[model samples]
Structures are given as C-alpha cells and as structure tokens.
Target chain A: MQYIHPKAIKVWRIHGMISAAISFVLFLVLMLLGLFLFRWLLYLAAGFLVIGLVDFLIFVSVIPILRWRFFRYRINETHVVIRDGIWFVKHTVIPMARIQFVEAEQGPLLRAYRLAKLKISTATSTHHIPALSIGQAQKLRDRLAAFIQASDVDV
Target chain B: MKRAHPLSIFAGFFKELKQLLLPIIIGALFGIRHDDGMSEWFALFGIGICLFFAVIEWWRTRYQVLEDQLYVKIGTIFMKERFIRFERIQSLHLSTNPFLKLFGLVRLEVHTAGGEDKAEFALPAVKRDEALRLQERIGGSNRSSQEDLLAVLDRSENSERVYRLRGGELVLAALTSSGARVIFLGLFTLLGQIGELWDRVSFITPLRREFHRVIGVPLLEAAAGVAAVLLIFWLLSSAIAFVKMYRFTLTVREKDWVIRRGFFEQTEQIVPFKRVQAVKIRENWLKQSFGYASVYLDVAGGQAGDGASEVLLYPLIRKERVAEFLAAIRSPFPWAVPTAAVSIRAFYWKIIKYVVPLAVLATILSLWVPYGAWSWLLVAASMALSWLGYRDASFAVDGDRVALGRREFSKETILTERKRLQFLSCRVSPVQKRLKLMTVQSGLIAGNNGYSFRICDLPLAEGRRLYEWYITAYTRSARRELQRVDGESSYSL
Candidate 1:
C-alpha cells in the first residue's frame, strides 16, 4: 500500500482556494447589497463573511492535509484497493478481471503541475487516483492495462 | 433475418398510441376544465400526427440476423441503428398480449448484457414459428444442448415440483405486498383527477361534501372519510393483485428455471442456469409476522413485459423453507449461513441519527401545540423503532455468497453470489472510525436501477476483509468461467 503523491495536498488546497475565492466574491456582492440596497441585510453580509472564513480555514487548510495523511491505495495480483477521504473514508476494491479500461487524464492545473489523474473503470463505476505525477500515472495505467491484458490472455 | 410479421405495423401504431394516451387524457381534462374546444382539437391533431409518424416508422424499420450480430435499423428522421452481437444477447423472450395473440403473433424482445435502460431490440410482432426460429438462431449451440437436456427431463418419470404459490397463499402474499398500496395510490390519483374535472357530478366531491355537511367538523370528518376510502381502496387493490399474480408457479428444468404466472395473460419466463446473477429474500411487516417471504432472482439482461419488474420466485414461501427453495433453484453457492452481527454500539448511532434530533424537535413542538402529549408518544415510538432496527441488522458471507439483512418496518435479506456483484464499496465516517465501524454497499448487474444492498456499522477490519474476500473470490470464479468461455469461443472462431 502507498499514499498518493504529496502534491495531492497542494492540489486539494488549490481546489479549496478556488472555492473560497468564489465564496469571497459572493460575500462581496452580499456586502454591496447590504450597504447600498437594504440596511437589515447587513446581518446576512456578516454571516456570509463568517462562512467564507470557515471555508478557507477548513476546506483550504485543514481538510486537505488530513485527507493526504489518510489516503492510501494498494494493487495486488487479484484486485485494486483504494482508501481515502477526510470526513467519510472509503475503501473500494475492484477485481482485476472486472477492469474494463484504464486511462490517464491531465487537466489544465494538473498539466501545469506535471500531474495526471489515473481513472480505473469497471462495469458499473469509475475510481480515480488523483494527483499522480504524469509519468507515474502513465506507468501505473500501463501496468494495470498489462495485467488486465495478461489475465485476459490466460482466460 | 427478415421483416417482421405484417401485423407489426398495427402493434407499433398501438404502442405509440399507448404512450400518447396519457398526454391526450391530460389535455382533454384541461379542455373540459376550461371549457375550451381549441385545446381538445389540438390534442386530436397531435394524435393524428403521432399515428402518421408511427406508421412511417413501422414501414421503414427492418431487422436482420447476420453471422455474429443481430442488426436493426429503424425510423426515418431519427434513423437509429443497432448492431448487437449474438453472444452478448442474454435472453430472447417471446410474449403475446391479447392483441397479438389474436393474430397468432408474439413480440420478440431481445436483451443484451450492456445494462441499458431499454431492451436491446424488440420486434413488435412476429409469427410464433418465426420467433422460435429466431430464438434458436440467436441462441446457437447452447440452446440446442439445453433443449436436449429439457427433452431428457421431460422423458423422466417424475419431474420435481420446485415451488408453487396456491390460491390462498397468493391472496395472503398480495395482501402483504406493496402492490396493494401502489394500486390504491394509482386509483386514488385517477379518482382525484376525475373529481377535479367534474366537480359538480363527481362521485368523491359529493361524498366529501356530504361528509362535511353531516359532520360539521373538518378534521374529524376528513379522517373518517380517508379511512373509508383507504378501506375500499385496499379491497380493490387486493382483487387487482389476485388477478395479476394468479397461478404463479416456478419450476426447475435441467438447465433453466421456468416462471409461469398470470391469469388473463399467461406469461412464461425462462431463465437459463448460467444467466442467473443474484437472488433475494424479502419479508414485509405482515409477511415477517406470518413467517412468510418472497424470493426474487436477478437474471442478467432479462426484461419482463408490460414494464413490470422481474417476477418473484413464488410471491409467498415459508421463511424457514427458504433454504429448500434455494436448493431447489440449484444455487451454486455453499449452503452454510454464517452471520456476522453488526456492532452493538450501532444502537447509539441509530439513536443519534434517527431519534435524538426528532425527539428534540418534537419536544420543542410540544411547547406550542395544544396536544403536546402526542409528541412524546411519537418520540417514544421512534426511539423504540431505532432500537429494534439495531437489533435486526446483520451481514454474512458463506463461501462465494453474501447475505445482507436489515429491518426498517420490514425485514429484507438479499443473498447474492460474489461473481454477480458489479460494484462493492466500504465507507468509514469519522464517527464510524472512532467506533471502529464501517458500512459496506453492493450492487448487481440485473435490474434497470441496479438492485443495491448495504450493511451498515460493521467492524471496519471485517468490512475490509469482506471487500478483499469478495473481490478475490469474484475474480477467481470469473476467471475460471471466462477461461471456459474463451476456449469455446476460440473453437468457434
């Protein structure tokens, strides 16, 4: 079993920061409305500011660190096991025989950081290994693909 | 590999008309309500256009069975095409409703293992002999061998009777089933609509008005009226269920399971042994009390006609006799039923999840409401229910099979083979982690919604072990089956 790349913490923090930015903009709009339109709505503006602060502290700062600390995955001869989450930890196991396909996806932010996400698909659902280095994602995908192919060949 | 029977055009037209029926009725209701002639005429015009298009679709549609695939092309403007491999075809169902039976034709519904929302392809109406030929062709080598086995079984002196729901048992089953509630709700809605449309002469509106007039009290009279209506609806629904589930019989053959059911429209569903994905045993409140249960099978890519779900194994069986029923069905998994109890601490969790907040809210409500004591009763009942729920929850794994048991108002135990599981997941909340607990959820590939089951608040370590064991066993069995299939497919190639 191994943890995902250390950079996943940074990626998660970046994701949280983006959410915080959106919330901050929303707070600004509410504050403007409170100042210019309705005085009673100033209470709403204050609540919005508090929520934004909490979002930054929890989602951007503390949560990602906890997630990175706990997240782990392992692949064996028969199945792939994934364990992750901060509030609700999940452990998912997909049998090698059930692996329908595997792919590596690089988003703009991930591409900028030279990271890729590996998605393993089965008959019903897809699981992801987030924030792997581009090369690592490619290598892992190839290895899993090879295992699936070899298993199929044996069958 | 030919055009369907000429009667298909009539079937296709009626099928399209059936879909249009709802909207047309709704439009007519609005027209009647508003006293508008234009809307009614518009609905009529819409029906005319739909009929015209349906005829066009029937004329253009064509299907052919090629070497390895059944190809179907339909529609003109939409121009849809489907190419389904023969091996992927899971079941070929031959069904004849009254309309089709009149012409000695049956609808051939072809289903595949792709798990789509709709059937892979349906030939609306085909001759019985032609449907049999198509079924044989699509099935190929396996069908012939299975037919030979069936022949042998037929020649045997005595054929085993697997399970049968007699008339009395079926009535009991229907009374306990959700079918009664569903029917009641459906009819109630229909009556409500009619009442709305014809407020002056309506049956319900006048009865309701008379009740209000006679009682002069709104709430009390309303309650009495509802009770009366519900009683009537229950009886009506029971009759409907009796008709729908009459003569339900499940028989075992050498290589298949045959489910014969229905009174007015006798339907025969044949599921080959290899196609069976999962089995379930369910008991509602009444059924549980009577020690009776219903069993359902998840057959891969199988579809039941008239939009009903997969038919039950017998609709009624003694709870203690479930093992015999499973054995009679020739389930492949080991027979031992070893249960792993959910942690006792789950009681507290259930209380926190269901009872505590509701109780708090009820207490607050008691401060304002005149009948404050009633709130206490509700809170007490909820607390008792939560405690009962904790006592009933358990999960077990025996060899290649997993059984998840849970109770809300009803107790349901779903038994599925490891290889049938399409997905399995284990979740541990922060609270659960502190309690050393987790929840395991699983889904099968059989139903349109993908029948899923969950076992909550199990030991985290045990949950992980179950996940590992399930995946490993599932993969090993799947590989063995695949190897055998691969060898046979190679020979064909």
Candidate 2:
C-alpha cells in the first residue's frame, strides 16, 4: 500500500471551501427570489457550513485510513496496474501504448506543501492520482516516460 | 496584423437586434395589454444591454497573428484569448457579401479538426487583399508541412498526382442530378408563404379590422394581397437557392480535397485525404432514374449541423464519374458493384419493429378520435416504407474495404477500410444472446468527428474475426507487442 502525502488534506479543504462559497451565493440568490423563508435560508446556510466542515474533517481525518488502503503503481512490461478503492476494490490496468500524455498539476495549496497530482491522459479518458510528494511524482513521470519510449522501440 | 473591419460590429449589432426585435416587440405588446411596468422596463433594459454589447464589440474586437499562431482577443469583462496553432489549421476560408464587397472586405475563417463550435476561428471582416495574402501564407506553410510529412512517409510522388474537376464537369454534374430537390425546396417555401399569409388575413380578425378602419378599404383588397405575397416568396426562394449553391466546385489537391461552394458567402473546406474515414456513394430511386449518384464523405472533422459527422462531397454527380473521382483520391472501393441484398429475415424484423408503434397509434385514434380508420393509412404507409428499407439494406466486401447500402427517406451507401478503424467492440444484448447473435461496432476516432462506420448485428464468430482483423491490420506499430506468457512452459516449448 502506498500512502498519499498528508498535504492532500489542504487541497481537499480548499476545494471544499470554493464549493461551499458557490453554494452560499446560490442560496442567497434563492432567498432573494423568495423561494425559502428566512429561517429556512438560515438552516440552508448552516447545512452548507456543516457540509464544508465535514469535508475538511474528512480530508484531515480520512487520509491515514486511505493511505493504509491504497497502493502505488509502477509500470510493468505490458501494462500499468493501479490497485486502490476502499470499500469496493478496483484494479485498473492500462496498456503503456495507450497513454497520450502525462501531466503533474500543482495548486497553490499543494505547491505550499510540496505535493502534486499525477494525471494520465489516454485517447478515451483521463485518470488522476492526487497527493503525491513532488519527488515521487517526478520519479513516476520519468519511469512511465522511459517505459513508453522503450515500448515505442519494441513496436 | 489584420484588424476586422470597423463596420462589422454595426453589422453584427444590427443582425442581432433584428433577431431579437420580434420577441421584444411581442413581449412589449403583451405587457402593454397587461399594463405591466416590469415588462416594459425589461424591454428597455434588453435594448440597452444589446446596444452596450454592440458598443463594446465595436471598440474591443481585434485579431492578430503571433509567429506560428493566430490570436483573436475579444470581450470586455470576461476577456477571452483564443489561440489557434498554424499546424493545426486545416483551412483558411474567405467569404464576402454585397455589404462587405462594397468595402472590399471578406470574412476569414480558420477551421481546425474538432467539434463544430470550436472548429472555426472567424474574423468577421478583413480587407480582401490582406485576407488573401494571409490565406496564401498560411496555406503555403501548411502545404509545405504536409509535404514534409509525406516525404517522411515516402509518398511524395503520389501526393503530386492531385485531381481537379473541370468547370464543365461540375456544371454537367449539377444539371443532370437531383438539382430538382432545390426546385422542390423552392416550392415548399412558396407553400409556406401562402400558408402564413392565409393565416394572417383569415385568422387575425383584429388586424384585418384595424387595416380596414385605417385605410377605408374593403376586405377584398386584403384578399388581393395573397397573390403579391406568393410571387415575392417564389422569387425569394429561387434567389436563395441560386445564391447559396451558385458556382459550386470541388477540387482535389495534394493530400487534401477542397470543396468551394456558395455565391454570396463563399465557403472553401480543405479536407485532408487521411482525415477521410469513409466514402459513401448513394443512389436513391429518383437519382437512379437519371443515372446520378450523390457522394457523401465521412471525414474526421465536424458534423454538417445534422448531428452526423458526414459531409456531402458532391451532393449530385454522374455515376460514371464517381469511379474516376474516387480513383483520383486512391479510395479503395469499386464505384459500381452488385451488393448482396438484405435477407427476408431482415425485412420481417423491420416490419415487426415498426408495426408495434403504428398499431398503438391506430388503436388510440380509433378509440378516442372521430377519424379512426384514417390512422390505419399511416400504418399501411409505414409498412410499405419498412419493406422498402429492408429491400434496400445490403452489405458488400470489396478487397480490404466494406460497403453498406441502406435506405430510409433516401438511399445511403457507405464504403470504409479496416485500417481506418480506431476501436472495435463486440456487444451482446439479452435478446441477441438468446439467439446467439452479437453486434460489432467499429469506431474510427480521427479527432472529435464521431464514429466513421458502424455495422450492427452479425454472428459472434464473424464479429470476433473482424475485430481480430482490425486489431492486427490497423494497430499502429508503436502500440503493437509480441505475445507474452504468464505461465505454461510446455506451451512455449
């Protein structure tokens, strides 16, 4: 099992805050439209606050649990297999040749924590594994790049 | 740097204002009747907002090329910077209207391979000479780049053998084909105008009373108006067809096919030969009578606003010339071949599929409406249509290519290559599973141009064989791998 960096909690918290802010604005608009009573509007705001708080709590509290549950990936001869998913276990295997591009994204919060999200894009879809240490993401990117380059030669 | 013509802003503003005026006026009238101040205020606010936008557009619209990329910077608040790479550009099209022609200006459109919404980067107005110069530079650069790629592919000689249709051939093709469809459309427009006028004069009692009261004329004067309206409509539709399709010509150049159509707003689409996924030559019963066929190309670009990624290459052409044209493109299908017609089972299946809906509609109409048996006529018509569809359904394999001929409102024949297939999937539904049947769908993703050719309902074994063939034949060398054993040393030995 591979552990996501503790810094991921900050990223989740920031995302939750942004979501809550947008929802609050929407709630205010609904209130202005006279769709809900004053008390109902207060309750709705409170509910959104609670959601935001819970989201932040989950980020901080659930990281260790997820880290214990997850697994890191390394490319094999043919495919890249990532085994992660808590209650419902999933093992995803993508062939190296199918990879279109690989990217490392870092938000301000993630950058502060020296963490990044590794993204793998294929012709059909994109997959992301967030909260990797900068060094780890770089190493993984290099490994995948080398593997793909080697596969190109064999083909 | 080429700036869009200053007058374009006014043109856009007026065009948008004209479109919104009817709705605004109607809403305002409704409001006036209801004595609603808010609706009046809304109308005023809408006009003000539109004027503001027009003003901003007039001031802020600008476009310029930066090195190998073209950028159009527009909007005031939510600033948008659209960048289009030169290499990604498929074609640079120029068009002009009478208004634009007065200024010696044209609209420039840069088309790329993707969704229709984002496929074109348009500059509404640019000086004709400058637009031409820019188009030439961009087109020349693209041609050189393509030539370089062709040289790498070792097919430079083949690229040199480009084919172009002469003016006489284009005119002949247009005359001998279902150009009569344009005539029929004109007639339809005439009928629509007559219907509108009849509704206005007969149904709108208040308008008629007001007109009579103001002019002190009898209702018979209004009845005379219908003749004038019909004549105007006839002239309008004919003029529209003439303007839209006048001087339509198709030309094939190295690694690209160009379709230059329209008179007032001329459009030239440069379609790369490699981007063509499927070639469909269709002949309806009407076309067959005149020995004409319509060619539709399933190119890897955007849809033709029809929710289908198929564009009509030559809407109407001679059946004999199809062979010559296709051969010029190195297209891999015989123009004329005896196709295997659909089985009787296919006809029965189609009947069963359509009959249920027809029967239900007939039952409801008969039970609840005065005209009951008349609904049965619809069912009969559907039965006949389904029979025709089944009879027309056919598929043929020509070398490494596959052709499917199907009929709906019109007959459609499609020919595609195995190498063009992007992905192949074999699907089994519960019903098909019971019958031991499978549906194979082969998709070619040459950008966002949707599926190239999809054939459904074949035997499972046949589907698997085709899927294997597609994988083995079409898989890029960079993606192919040797069989690897996880276990079983004896098998390896």
Candidate 3:
C-alpha cells in the first residue's frame, strides 16, 4: 500500500478552514441576533458555538488521519487501485487499458506544496488521487501510458 | 433528381416569422387598442429582429461539397464549421416538401456514425440531380475504398448486402410495433375530449344520473364491468393499429436497409451495413400467439424518439424470415440459434433477491403506517414479476458470436461479435461472493449511449470464461498488426 503524500493534508486543511470560517461567521451573526432578540435565546447561541467548535476540531483532526489512511496507485502490469475509508473500506480498481486520458491537476494549496493530483478517466467514469510529488506523478503517468500502449498492442 | 426548392428558404423564413408573429400581433393589438406608443415600438422591434434573421439565413444558407468532405458552414456571428468525411459518411438523405418538389429540389442531409452532436451535416438547398450524383459518387467511392482496404488487410469476407421491405410488410411491421400504441393514444385523447364536450352539453347528464342510480351492483359485478371496459380498450387499441399501419414498407438496396412509412408525412431512413452494432430479435407473449416476431437493429447513432424507432430496419417479420433476412444482409451471427437457458438458480435468485428488499420496505411501512398487508401483496407481485423475467433470460455463445436474450415487457435477443466489445468487467459483489457467483458486464463503444450490455449473476467460472474469451478475441484480432510493428518500441510515449 502506497500512502498518499503528506501534502494532501494541507489541501484538506485549506478546505476545512474555509468551511470553519463560514460557520464561525454565521455563528457570530446568530449569537448577536439572539442577544438583541431575546435574553434567554443567548444560551442557545452559546450551545451552537460549542457545537461549531467541536465540529471544527473534528474536521481539523480528521484530515491528517485520512491522508495517512488512504493509499492509491498503479502497479506494473496491473490496474490503478485506490483504497480508502477507515471502516467499510472501498477499493476501486481501474485498468490502465480502460483509461482514456490522464490529467494532472494542481489547486492553489497543492501548488504551494508543488504537488499535483493525477486524475484517470475511463470512457464511463473518472477517479482522482491528489497530492503527489511532481516526480512521482510523472513516473506514474509514464508507467500508465506504457501499460495502455501495451494493452492497445494486444488489442 | 430533386433539388431543394429555391423557395424552401422562404418557406423556412415564413415558418420562423409565423412563430414570431404571435408576439408581434399581440404587441400590435395592445398598442392599437390601448394607444400605447411603447407597444408599437416593441412590434417594430420584433419586425426588425425577424428581418435580421432572414438576412443572416440568406447569407449563410448555401452548402457545397469540396473534395473528400462535405462542408456545411452555417450560423452568422457564431459560425459553425462542419466537415463530414466521405469515408465516414454512412448515408446521404434527400427530403422535400411539396413546395420543394415544385421547385425540383430537395433538402440533403449527410449522416455519419460518430458523435451525436456532430453526426448530421445538412445541405438545405441543393439541386436534386447534384444531390443524387453526390450520393452515387460517395457511395461508389466508399465501396471501392473498402475493397482496397480489404485487399491490403488480406481479408476476403463477402461484402454486406442491403435489404428493403415491401409495402405490405412495412405496414404490417409498423402496425405490430409500438406505432399501434401511439395511434391508440392519439385516438383515446380525441375520444376523451369528445366525451368531455358531450358531458358539458348536458346530452349525457341524464344518462349518467340514471346509470349511477342503477349501480347497486355486487362487488363481483363491478369487477366484471372493469374487465369489460379493459377488453373494450384493448379492442380500440387494436383498431388504431389497422389505420396507422395502412401502407408501411421496408426495402433493402445493396448494403443499405431502407424503411419508408407514414400515413400523412412520409418518412424514409436508410441504415448502412457497417453502422449496425447488433441485431436484436425480440418476442413477446402476444407475438407468440400471432406467430410473429419484432426485429430491431442496434444501429449506432440512432435515437428512438417519442414512439418511433430511430432506425426502423424491419418493423415486424415472421420468425422464419429472420434467417433469410440475416443471410441476405450477410449478418455474421447465426440466425435464431438456441442458446443455453439460464439456470433455475437464476429464477430462485431473482425471486429471493427482490423479496428481501420488498420485505424490508414492508416491515418498515407496516410498523409505521396503515395498509401494511397491501405492502405484503406488493412484495408478492414483485417477486412473481422477477421470477418471470429470470425464467425468460438466457444467453448463448456460437463460435465467435455471442447472443444475449432478456425478456421483460418485451423479449430482446442481441447478437454481437466478441471483438466488438470495448471493455469487459467481472464483478463479485458481497452477496455474489456469498453465493459463489459473479456478474460480467460487457461494453461496446456506442458513442453517447455509452456501455450497452450489463449481464449479471453468472457462475464465477462462466464469468471468467467469458472475460478470457473477450481478451483472447481482441488480442488475436490485433496480433498481426502488433507483429508488424515489433521493433518500434518507442510507440509507448
């Protein structure tokens, strides 16, 4: 099993931070509205703030754990496999021969780390594995292309 | 040879202008009646818009073929550049209205078996003789090109033959197919409107009141009345079949299948030999009684719309004639060959599998709501239906050909070559794992329709066998080409 790059945690953290900020602002507005509308409702606003904090903490903690748990990739002479989930694990195996195209994408956060996400698309569906070092992504792409050409030759 | 009428543009312009006329007239009326200058201005604006469109159409409407490709350049500001290669071209269609016929011209549409978005290239106003000459030249060149390619490839398979349907057969075929249902639906709507009008006019008011008072009928009597109404409906539907399918005909010419039908607006479609992906022979319970079967070609790039088959090769034919038709077309598959019937395990699995889901839903619904017993009845009906479907399902492998038969409301048997499969997958679900079974889905590259066939619940060994056959067939087909390029290892990049 190949571990997803640690830099993937940074991408997830960026996503989580955006979500947290939105929720935090909403919480602040609701609290202010409750204080103006009803004295008793301020207690409900406090409870909501506590729940938001807990959710933010969970989101912050889970990203790194998920990055550690997930493994994806292509093996020589075989399909590309992405194994994920802490429980009720999912393993998606897409044959290289079926791959129509390979796209390497870099979002803003991933660009900061110089990491790219490799997306493999078949005729029917697409799968993505994010935060790979540039060198690793290139090597994987070369191997995938080689496998695809070999299979096409055998077609 | 019929050229698309020079006046055809005016007809189109008039049609478009007529569509816009409603808003224009409404605005004009509003302006005149309400004495509003703004409405008058809006009406003038509409006229300006219509004239602008007419001018644009006049400029960009002309089409001419150059060399090996048909080019159709249309649109004004957002210009469309369409090219249809002569080799990729399947058929050139000529259609004309009475006005176009008067002008000795017809609309020419070139169809290719490719992307749905880019399949048709149309020439709206071509002379009839020129269009015919173009079709002949393209068709002739296409044949010779294939012959040359075959010689180079060293394959001497006989060229495909085209089939045509006779007028009587075409009518019969259309009548037996879903065309009958469409006619019935139309008539039913008409009758419903008449009935509503009759009720409004107080003509049937006294009769309805009398009938209601006389309706102290028993439960069984009411059930019998319902059955009688259903029987009358069925008779009405069959009557519609006779009227609509009055003059249907199908024809085969060389390597093309032609179907011409319609009571009012006649439609003709040609299906080329190469475009047919699979031939589906279907049967239904009623068809068995009538000694008739429906044949459909799974032709690429045709879409069924409303109630019409996009490409109607042969609407309805006797089962015995299927073999002769197949032989005439040089269809690669064996004609109506018997295949292995699905195991009784198929029946049991289908029933039990459906029952479990229904049972779960029934338990929940019964626990939380009324009419719980009815939910149990629903489960029973579903299980029965699934059992019937499973019993009707079967598949066969005859040499290089695979035939799959699936029966639901209608029975469909699809015949395809192993090499045509774009991809094959063997899936073992958790339930299938427990049962030592697997499902094998075979996909053909069918443009926008995507993967065509999904076969499920085969024994693991059988699924593996099918998968191996697919891989072997594909590899064998390409082996010679690969061997020729043996030393060129740099192709991987």
Among these predicted structures, which one has the highest TM-score?
A: 1
Residues A86-138, model 3: lDDT tens digits = 53234455555556678888877788888888888765456777769878888
Docking class of 3: incorrect
lDDT measured at residue B366 in model 3 versus the true structure, 0 to 100: 88
- Clashes found in each candidate (C-alpha, N, C closer than 3 A): 0, 0, 18
> For residues A1-155, could you state the per-residue lDDT of candidate 1 as single tens digits?
79888888888888888877877887888889889999877788787778788889998889888888888898765678888776787878777765768999988878878899999976557888887898989988888988777655221
Better of 2 and 3 by lDDT: 3
Model 3 chain B worst lDDT run, 10 consecutive residues: B146-155
Looking at candidate 2 chain B, the ten consecutive residues that score lowest on lDDT are B484-493
- Sort candidate 1 into its docking category: acceptable
How high is the CA lDDT of each candidate model? 0.69, 0.57, 0.58
**What is the DockQ for all candidates, taken in turn?**
0.41, 0.04, 0.16
| Model 1 per-residue lDDT tens digits across residues B1-493 | 3778778877877777877865665454334444555766776787787777767766777898788888898765888888888877765666667888898888777765544646767888888777767766776834533343233223342446656787689889878776335544754654575345335423456677788789878556545655665665566567667877888877777766677777756666665556566666777666777888888776554454433445466688888888986786786442334377667788888788878988888888889865454567557867876776666667678766677677655666767666567567899888888888778877665544345567777777777778777766646566666556544211011
Of 1 and 3, the candidate ahead on TM-score is 1
lDDT score of residue B210 within candidate 2:
63
Q: Output the better candidate (1/3) by lDDT.
A: 1
Better model by DockQ, 2 or 3?
3
The regions of model 2 sitting more than 4 angstroms off are A1-155, B10-55, B64-71, B82-91, B112-120, B132-243, B283-291, B301-309, B318-321, B328-341, B407-409, B428-430, B433-438, B445-447, B456-493
Return the candidate ranking by lDDT, descending: 1, 3, 2
